[model samples]
Target: MLKENKYCCEDHVDMAFDDFLVEKETFPCLEKSEDSKCSYCNKKAEYVLKLPS
Candidate 1:
């Protein structure tokens, strides 16, 4: 079951699903950036998973 949307860190503050898509689309090279750390664990977000709504 899906629980409430949970963010691991403040970087994802107020970010919606669409926002994630837009960010991914707009910044395709973010994966190579040092600042692209995971909002929860501070690890690198090497991949993005799109869950069904």
Candidate 2:
């Protein structure tokens, strides 16, 4: 499903997958300071967790 490709938000922004990986690799388990929005749609993301573990 979406998890396989590393998508988090309901909108499934392309950058979400890449951002998740970068965040995990660089700063695992770190909390996000701000909300994330979908790049393609420019809407508020609906990710279960703002920051991926």
TM-score per candidate, chains pooled: 0.23, 0.29
lDDT of candidates 1 onward, in order:
0.39, 0.45
Model 1 C-alpha lDDT per residue in residues 1-53, reported as the tens digit of each score? 43222232344433534455554443221212333455457765443333334
Which 10-residue window in model 2 sums to the lowest lDDT?
1-10
* Best-performing candidate as measured by lDDT: 2
Which candidate has the highest TM-score of all?
Answer: 2
Model 2 agreement with the true structure over 1-53: per-residue lDDT tens digits: 12322324555544665576665554223233246564446566554233333
- State the local distance difference test value for candidate 1: 0.39
> lDDT of candidate 2 vs native?
0.45
Model 1 C-alpha RMSD to native = 11.4
